[model samples]
Target: MCRSKIFRICLLFSAGYPLFQMTLRLIERTFYYPVSEPVDTFTILDLMFLGIVLAAFVSLYLGREYSDGVIRNKLIIGHSRMSIYLANLLTVTLGAFLMHGIFFLAMFLLGRLYGLPMELGFGELAPAALLGFLFIIAYASIFTMVSMLTASGSVGPVVALIIAFFLMIMGISIYSALSDMYAEIPPELLADPGFNPLASRPKWQQVLFPLLYNALPSSQAMQLMDYVAYAGAAKAGHLSTVVIEPTVFPLLAGTSALYDLLIATFTTAIGILLFRRKDLN
Candidate 1:
């Protein structure tokens, strides 16, 4: 069953990988790709990374749920439900890491083909890989929780993708509101560099929205890619910021890691609890 799951996953990504890579390469050559503009918006990395992450995540969690015929045959002399859930989580996380490994390999090869320098210290690369894997794993767990309410493998990823889409829309809406209110400043209001754009309320405003408006995993992935973009640009002797609409208090990738860990705990615990009550015929 485990081997079947891995095989299916590899097959799915194998078909999808070439198209995404080709598109990215085309975009890079045209120089009309993501992050080329002055206005901040989702970059190509955002879509590619998120698409890969979401696909891998949904495949792993939901795939595991249905792939194991024996596991679903809970009527047999069964193992502990708690053990089942933990096993699923562990398996899903391992799947996420494996998927991430594939993604990074593809990305690095593409980077090399495009003549981009792909150098990084082993220490830096290790943590980055760990962070990316964790992000995907957490995201998969959340979607797995969603799948518990439904019965289809397709349902889990479709719902997650839709929800993720809407999350991006919501972020855009918030960004639009922020832009209209701030980007077009009065000449008298904007001449100073010390003006705080995101400072309407005190710094504590973050706490209020932390739950009200969560950042999408793609946007957060883009946040990391943006840094990679910046570092690449800076290496070329340019220090300009990437055109991602600045969050008044931009959540760095590390900060997103903190959020991922916290959110994963809640979502995964709930999923485990729900799995315990699963009525497998």
Candidate 2:
């Protein structure tokens, strides 16, 4: 994995992209905004592309291993299919973590160099970081499962990429629906005492939207990004003063982590079971 050119390229991207984003943010904060508010080191869109990249990487890696008979050779050498699947999962998860770590380190160092305030303290940042790690694990489990189950190495990446896009689109749709449903009423409408925003929406949508938002990995990423941005703005004394309640944010973060763990565990178990029954020949 270390010698793979794709891994090397991903490493480069993981390290370089943060620096590039920080530079752009710095420029935008300095020249574009009239008020010159403190630039946030973290953005709501930070990890949006990570899912697609990891999907592509894991799919390609597994495909190569399958094509070159590495998996078959491992079985011949007495490794169980379960063990092989887990080993690959662990390798990819660690690689994803390394990429995430590089991004965080770059963002922090740049934030310091550029004199941007560290908005969230260790207490607040730790859970967000853990949530991000769990998210990566979930992504790894999903792509590894898809890639391992598919016979053709060439076909795995295409399928994995499609799944990644589908998850992203679904997340976006859920987010938009929630936004529209909860949009603030016009002042004139609010002036009427009986106006109720919840009355117009169906009961099922009220329940389902929030459930999917918390449950899906893509939606969780979006929520996590929003939390980070809100926390930063609150700490920086920006106009967006209404911050998420301190305790509420932690509870939400914990819930999101639990969801991610369930996803990773469920997907991995299913993958191992399927691979065990697969015929290599």
Candidate 3:
């Protein structure tokens, strides 16, 4: 995997993209916005691109291994199916982290040069960073599961990328619905007794939208970005226009992290079971 052309290209992207974004943002913040104080430099949303990148890389890597019969050769050499599955999971997860770490390093270095600090302190940042890492693991588990079960290396990437794209679209749709539903009403509308916002929506939508937003990895990523934005704003002693209530920030972050943990665990277990029964022929 390390020697593969795909791996090298991903590494370059992981590092270069963040640097490019940071530079653009810095220029924008300096010339267009012209803030007097340092601003928040990084957010979990910055790493969201990794979803598609990792999906493609993991699927293609596993596909190459499958085509070359490396998986079968490992079994022939006495490695158990479970061991092989876990090994792949670990490798892919590590690769994802390496990419994430590179982005972080690039962002941090650039932010420092531009005199922009992360705004949120260590205590505030740690949990968000940890949750972001968990999201990465969840992404790896999902793509690894899809690729490992697939017989054709070529087919694996297509399936994984489709799933990633679908999840992203679904997440965005849910988020937008929730945002519209919860958006603040005008004072006149609020005073009108007949204008209850919740009255128009079905009960199921009210419950399901929040549940899906917190549960899906892509939605969680979006939520984290909002959380980070709100936190940065609050830490800077400014009013946050972000719709998420600051009081529920901890609750949302905790719930999102829990979902990520559950996703990674569930996907890995199911992948192992399915791979054990998969025929190499």
lDDT of 3 at 10: 86
lDDT of 3 by residue, 112-219 (tens): 677665677656665776667878888999999999998678899999999999988899898777677657654456445576445667988767776788888888
Q: Give the candidate number with the greatest lDDT.
A: 3
lDDT of each: 0.54, 0.76, 0.77
Locate the minimum summed-lDDT window of 10 residues in model 2. Answer: 239-248
Give the runs in model 2 whose Cα sits over 4 Å from its true position.
Answer: 28-38, 41-45, 121-123, 185-200, 239-247
Model 3 residue 195 lDDT score? 64
Q: Model 3 off-target regions past 4 Å? A: 29-33, 36-43, 121-123, 184-200, 246-249
TM-score of 1: 0.68
Selected candidate, larger lDDT, 1 vs 2? 2
Query: Each candidate: how many clashes?
Result: 2, 0, 1
**Model 2 agreement with the true structure over 71-134: per-residue lDDT tens digits:** 8788898999999999999999998888777777677668667765567765666567667787
Cα lDDT of model 1 by residue, 196-271, tens digit? 5446645665444333233555555545555555644554576653333332223455576677777678887887
TM per candidate comes to 0.68, 0.86, 0.87
Off by over 4 Å in 1: 5-69, 113-129, 153-158, 171-195, 201-215, 241-253
